[model samples]
Target: MSTGTIITGLRHRFRQLNEKPLRDDLIFYFAIIAVASVLFMALPLLTGEAAETDGMHRAWFIVAGTLIVLVQGLITGAVALLAVSLVEHFFLLFVDVHREFEKTMKSAVYALAPLILFSRAVLLGVSFAGLLLLAWFCLSTYFGVWIFHEKSKDRAVFVALATDAILAFYLHRWTVGPWLAL
Candidate 1:
């Protein structure tokens, strides 16, 4: 599918989420994520690095990096989906929601599409834009969960923010701790 089509579909999905039934097409969701992953993987190359490098080394590096990114992105995406599913399931126990587990997963993935796209641009080196995008991402995530849990909108936002904070803490601890020690 074309980029325009995908963006339109995502916009429609988010806009009509309350009115329409949740989509059941796993393949479509997978395609969206895969395309996002490819874009993310290519960010470095497209921005400037590809122009900086020349000859065989550049070719080899691109090939290797692309493979690594593809594999890592898929793995990370799968793990994240699983985590979201589990978290949703846990949340469902206390608060009854309209959608099922799989449907929730689909919605969450759909919500992440914009985030994935914005992150690719950020990765390409726009710090200020990245900061703005990050704020947008957080708001979008809160709204996404809020929309899903119609009866418990406040709870949904709380859970989303809390989990995000926890994730950030862990990421910072692991990723920055070693560098700081030096």
Candidate 2:
């Protein structure tokens, strides 16, 4: 999916997906993680903060750190995908919608388009727009779920929204809880 589709919503992305069943969604997911990791480091570098290390060359440290972040980001991202898809499926069960795991995965991965361009803004303390993107991300995922189960509009909305609420709460806690404590 192109960057332009992020603003168009999950329905458009799913249409593109249906047109191209062979597209590799994992690459999209990893690309988003990469973008996020770069944003995570961008502020520090821009602010002239140094990458302090114990006798390690600064360049080497940055390279090594980037590699570590990429790998760790992939692993963590995979776990999150699985967990979210599972939750999406569980929510579908309540509505008697038996969507496949891969469909839910499609919903999760394509919904990540919002994060690709905006998550860094949030992490960098751009609160208002980032919060909008965050809400968009949540809504898109639920919308994707509803799209997958087209037969039950009301039930789909309920299950999808409930699932999103649960996932969003846990995600905020895990991702921001430490900073909140400070």
Candidate 3:
């Protein structure tokens, strides 16, 4: 699909997060995750200092780097899916919402469309844009959860904050920590 089509689809999905039969669309969801993961993983190559190595060494390095990016991307995507599922489950405890786990997870993943698209700016070191994108991500994530729960405005805000915090902590521990070690 075209970029415009994807963006339009995401916007439509965002608006209808509260409606019935939330589309799982695993193919699209996984595609977004894959693209974001690959792009994020390749940021180092795009912005890192150039090495003074020979041809073979460079080739090997590129191959190794590509493999690493692919593997990490898949892992990060899977972790994110699981994280959303867990967060939704935890939130359901206090709230009286009646939503299916799979639908909730789909909402959570689809809501990340903007952040995934904006991630390129963050990876490119646009600090101000990155910060705005971060805020947008948090807000979108909150809305996603709110749609599923149909809770009060205050409760929805709380759920969003709690979900973002939990997701940030989990991702930092699993994804960022290891990346920083490299």
Candidate 4:
């Protein structure tokens, strides 16, 4: 009940979540987002909705598009990190001490099932409009992390921004060209 005890508990939980497998998973998810972001960048370009169309114009669009992709990479990275933090807190309630971190990670993966579907729904219905963003920010920040981990204040924000950037990049490239068959 002391502030120091709470901080210690939070730190322990954070370390547990950042173990080897969990970190690997986090990295993998960010890579997926990075690829997806490139696709997203190509969308407006292929459709000819990009700000510039002519030779000089195209050059401008390319520069702007690249910037967007980079931002996307940062955002998705943040999402992966946020997911890990949320997983940690949610798992804490269901398991014993030793299992807490792993359970949290698994639970976070499960949580993404709904978030992905929901985000798709939002995108299909409205694209990347402000309203959908407002909704995502509200949900991912307040209900997602804060409710579960009382100490999740900083984690939710930093992770969300990073993941959003990564996802944006993934989407940008996929929109632009032929998919690399893997």
Highest TM-score among the candidates is held by which one?
2
| Stretches of candidate 4 exceeding 4 Å from the true structure | 1-20, 94-97, 100-103, 106-121, 126-182
Residues 15-104, candidate 4: write the lDDT tens digits: 454444656655555555655566566666778777756887788778777778868665865676465555445434332223345434
Q: On residues 1-182, what C-alpha lDDT tens digit does candidate 3 reach at each position? A: 99788756655665675554434445666777677766665666677764556689977987777778777866767776777767866776566667667756765776566666566775555535544654665676666665555567677677667776765674453324434655
**For each candidate, what is the lDDT?**
0.59, 0.67, 0.64, 0.49
Clash count in backbone of candidate 1:
0
Residue 46's C-alpha lDDT in candidate 3? Answer: 70
Tens digits of per-residue lDDT, candidate 2, 1-182, equal 88658646656666666444424777777788877776666557667785655455777877777778777877877787777778877877787765567777777776666655565665556536544655676677766776655535577567667766776687674445546867
- The candidate scoring highest on lDDT is 2
Q: What's the lDDT for candidate 2? A: 0.67
Model 3 segments more than 4 A misplaced: 1-12, 15-24, 41-50, 113-125, 128-131, 149-154, 168-182
How high is the lDDT of residue 135 in model 3?
Answer: 60
lDDT of 3: 0.64
Better of 2 and 3 by lDDT: 2
How does residue 23 of candidate 1 score in lDDT?
A: 54
How accurate locally is residue 133 in candidate 3, as Cα lDDT from 0 to 100? 54
User: Alpha carbon lDDT of residue 28, candidate 2?
Assistant: 72
Q: Which scores better on lDDT, 1 or 2? A: 2
